[model samples]
Target: MTEAITVMALRQGVYDHFREEGDVFEIRKEDDFSAFWMVKVSDAEALALQKAAQRQPEASRHVVDTTVIDNSELEGLRIQLAEKNAEIERLTRNVPGKQADAPEKSAADVLKMANDPTVEFMTFKAAARKVLGDATPSTKAEIIAALEDKATAP
Candidate 1:
C-alpha cells in the first residue's frame, strides 16, 4: 500500500522512493489548510496536471486590462516635466555661490572683497591678477596696493 505524504515530508525521506521509472508525485492541497498539500500520483497524471496549471495562468492573463496612455496625455506629462525642470533650474540659479558670471567689480569693490573675511583668497587673487596683468599678488596688502596703483593709472 502507498503512503500519502505532505509536501514537507518529501524533503525528509520520501524523495528517495521516486527513483524507480514512471514514479510521480501528485500534490493535492488540503481544503482547510491552504499551504498544506498531500502528495501521491501516476507519471501521466502529474504531467497532465502540470500542463493544465500552465494553461490556467495563460487564460487568466487575457482577462486583465492593459494600461495605455493617449498621445494628448503623454504630451501633457512631457510639458509638465519640462516646466518642473525649468523651475528647478531657476531655483538652483538663485542658490548662493552658483552664479554663472560675477558682475564686474570696481577698484573699490575689489578692495572691499579683499577685506571681507568670507571671500576666498584665490577668488580675490584671480580678480586682482586680471587687473594687475602678470603680477599674482599673494597677500591682502600687496593686492590692495596693486589695485590702488591700477586705479590711479591713466
Candidate 2:
C-alpha cells in the first residue's frame, strides 16, 4: 500500500522544506486548526514522491510549446499569404466599372471634403458620373487610375 501523509496546517516553511528536500507525500489539511501534518512516508522513493505530490497540481489540461516553428509550416503560411494577395488584386480588377463613383465618397473622400468644405460628397459622385458617363474601356482605366491615386495619396 502507498504510504500517505496528511498536512493539517500549511506554513511557508513546511512548503519550502518539502520543495528543497524533494520529498513527496499526500497531504490533507485540517479543517478545525491552522496546523497541517505532512503525510508520513518511510521509503526514500516514497518520500520523494510525496514531496512532489505536495507541489502544485498541473492546472492546464493541455500544454502547448510555442517555441517550435517548422520551415515547411512557415513556407505554407507564406504561400497562403501570397495567394490571398493575388486573389485580392484579381477581385479588385473585376469590380464593375459602372459604379465608378462609389469610392469617391469613401473615408479618404470624406477627409478631402472636410478640407474643401465647398465640395459636397454627393457632388463628387455626380462629377465622377458626368466625367465617366457609361462604362467604356477608357472609363475603366480612368477609374482604376483614380483608385490607385486615392490609395497612394496621403
Quality of model 2 by C-alpha lDDT: 0.48
On residues 1-154, what C-alpha lDDT tens digit does candidate 2 reach at each position? 4333433223223543433233343444333222343334446657566565557454321144434668898899999999999998877875644465465444354334334668654555444444444541234345545644554768
lDDT of each: 0.61, 0.48
Clashes of each: 0, 21
**Model 1 Cα lDDT, one tens digit per residue, 1-154:** 4444333222223344532222234334433222322345455667775576566655343433335557898799899999999999989987644665867667767777888899888888877776677876778788899888777778
Who wins the lDDT comparison? 1
Regions of model 2 farther than 4 Å from truth:
1-64, 97-154
Cα error, residue 60 of model 2, in Å, equals 8.9
